[model samples]
Target: MSNCSFCQVIDETLRPGGIAIWLMKEAKEDIKYQVPFLLAVYLDENVYNGALNFNPWRWMEPENEEKRNRRTSPFYAPFGGGARFCPGAELARFYIALFFYYFETTYR
Candidate 1:
C-alpha cells in the first residue's frame, strides 16, 4: 500500500544522499536545507490512497481535478521538482512509451 519514491530506489542500490534531488521546506521553523533535504512528508491520507491504489480514472475526472490539493490529493511526480527535476524524466517516459508501442505491435 505504498508507492514511495525513496523506497523505489532503495533496492536499486542508491546510497544515502546519492541522488539528492528531492527537497522540501523544513518543519524546523527557521531552519532550512543548506544543501538538499532527503525526505518529504505528506501528512494526509488521500495522497497515500492515490498512490497505494490504482485508479487512473480519477486523473481524467473534472471533479477530482478540482479537488486535487497538493497536500491531500494524489498526483504522480516521480522525478523531483523545480531546478532539481530530473533531466532524464522525458527520456525515461520516451523509453517506456517505445517499449509499450513495440510490445503492443508485436503481441497484437
Candidate 2:
C-alpha cells in the first residue's frame, strides 16, 4: 500500500461524509472482483488488467491530461511523507536492489 497514492488520499480523507462514499466505491469495486471469484468461470480480464499495469513489463503510456491532472493533484502522493511514511519502504527497496544484484550476477 506504500506505493499506492490512492490509499494515502483515502487515509487523509477519512472524514464522516467522505468516508461513506469512499467505502461504497471501494465495496463496489471489491464486489466486481468477488462475484467472479465466487463463480467457477475463469474470466481473467479484470485480474489481468490490474496485475499487468502494476508490473514493470507491459508498460503503457498515460494520457497527457491524466498525467497533468496527477501532477496537479494534491492528494496524489505516491509515497506518504513526514513521520507517517511507509514502514516497509526501506525493506522493499533493499529486496528490489538485491533482486537486481542477483539477476545481474547470475545472468551475466
Q: Pick the candidate with the highest lDDT.
A: 1
lDDT of 2 by residue, 45-64 (tens): 34223321233221222421
Estimated TM-score per prediction? 0.45, 0.28
* Lowest lDDT 10-residue stretch of candidate 1: 9-18
lDDT value for candidate 2? 0.31
Per-residue error (Å), model 1, residue 56: 2.1
lDDT of 1 by residue, 1-108 (tens): 123332233211221122443545547576644754332322224433343333444434554443333223223334554565678855664565567567768994
Model 1 residue 59 lDDT? 38
The runs of at least 3 residues in candidate 2 whose Cα sits more than 4 Å from the true structure, single-residue gaps closed, are 1-78
Worst 10 residues of 2 by lDDT: 15-24
| TM-score, predicted candidate 1 vs. hidden true structure | 0.45
Predictions: Cα RMSD each: 9.8, 12.9
List, in order, the clash count of every candidate structure: 0, 0
